[model samples]
Target: MKTYPVKGSVKLADGKPLASGVVVFAAPEMGMEFSSPLGDDGSFVLRSSYGDGAPEGTYKVRIERDPSKADSQARGGRKSAAPAPYPAKYGDESSSGLTAAVKPADNALDPFVLVK
Candidate 1:
């Protein structure tokens, strides 16, 4: 088993932080998926089932924000599921158009900017 440190941030096209989202790295060739929660700054670290890092391979990345969480936070904790700020295309691996190739070293991915 091999792994590498992977990390990056997500931003809107206008340069605002995505705030809260889940970062997914899907490696269908290896039959594995790694994920991590985005911080308030939209930064995330990829962690696989093996933990702490991801298997060395090519991966399609997707970042999805939980609308309910965003709504509640926006309304100061009153629970509500709002519409997603990003387009639907950004929520799926096949549509996001984001990819990364992880190596056996600290892989600092480039920042992803989601646009309509």
Candidate 2:
């Protein structure tokens, strides 16, 4: 098996650390989709399930939080089941906050920033 490394940072619009989020990779032209949830530090390592990694190209990545987790809190024992404050959006190289294109040249892209 082979693996490729990719680094990232997840944060809210306020510039606060966003502990959890999903990074989706889709190559519509090739009918492929690959995604991974970010770590606490908002970093990720993208690889292929079948060792068929993402092809070198600009892809539209959608990011969002886990649906199972409740994002609300209350003073009492009760908890708010409010819907997620942040929705997902499709991102390209330019929109992904990368100085370089989201291709294989340097094999790395800039940290993606998500608005609150």
Candidate 3:
């Protein structure tokens, strides 16, 4: 299986970085999937479980906010008040409206912008 480095940034509707989250890429046809944690600036570099980059294919992209990280940053570390920053719709592959095509030679993906 070939691998290619895939990196990109995510931004909120207001044009600010997403801060922290997880970005998932699923290529069901190829039985390949990968995910990466978002940086403080909402940047991510996709890496597979085998420590290799993702294989070439089109992927369904999903972005989910990390609740544990959110809770700790929620002023008092309270879990209840730590609502997700992005809408629930964007957390699933079916509704995220995000996708990517990893070419055999290219290494980086374009930035993703999430809007409310």
Candidate 4:
């Protein structure tokens, strides 16, 4: 298999699940990307290649949903306040003790947080 699924929920700043929306994953360095659809439960899953995960760098993630699609696709999700902010950070590596450029296919990017 060349893919795996990542499960998570899209929640509001208030910590409530967002019924429907779209999440996009972009890794410029590795040129790999993915996206997932938010279900009524505000949960989603993005596909990652065999060993492809978020690299050790910054990412620009956006969440937007077509309201019109709601009537056609909304099983039980909400129309969200607004697509969150432009560019949310994911799988950073600055916090890690090791300081090196990402080398995917062999090295894994550990947990790192963005310094907003």
Output the number of the TM-score-best candidate: 3
lDDT of each: 0.83, 0.56, 0.82, 0.47
Q: Is candidate 1 or candidate 2 better by TM-score?
A: 1
| Clash number for each model | 0, 1, 0, 1
Query: For residues 1-116, could you state the per-residue lDDT of candidate 1 as single tens digits?
Result: 77889999888888898888898998887778898888889888987668677987888988877665676676665675666668888889999999888888998888988988
- Steric clash count of candidate 4: 1
Residue pairs in candidate 3 whose N, alpha carbon or C atoms collide under 3 angstroms: none
Give the Å error, residue 1, model 1.
1.8
- Position 84, candidate 2: lDDT: 48
What CA RMSD would you report for each candidate?
2.0, 4.6, 1.6, 8.1
Best by lDDT: 1
**Candidate 4 deviant stretches above 4 angstroms:** 48-60, 67-116
What's the best-to-worst order under lDDT? Answer: 1, 3, 2, 4
In candidate 3, what are the lDDT values of residues 1-116, reduced to their tens digit? Answer: 66888888888888888888899998878776799999998899888766556887888999987877877776654565655666778898889899998887656777888888
Worst 10 residues of 1 by lDDT: 68-77
Worst 10 residues of 4 by lDDT: 91-100
Which ten contiguous residues of candidate 2 have the minimum total lDDT? 93-102
Q: After superposition, how far is residue 88 of candidate 1 from its true place, in Å?
A: 0.7
Candidate 1 residue-wise lDDT at 47: 77
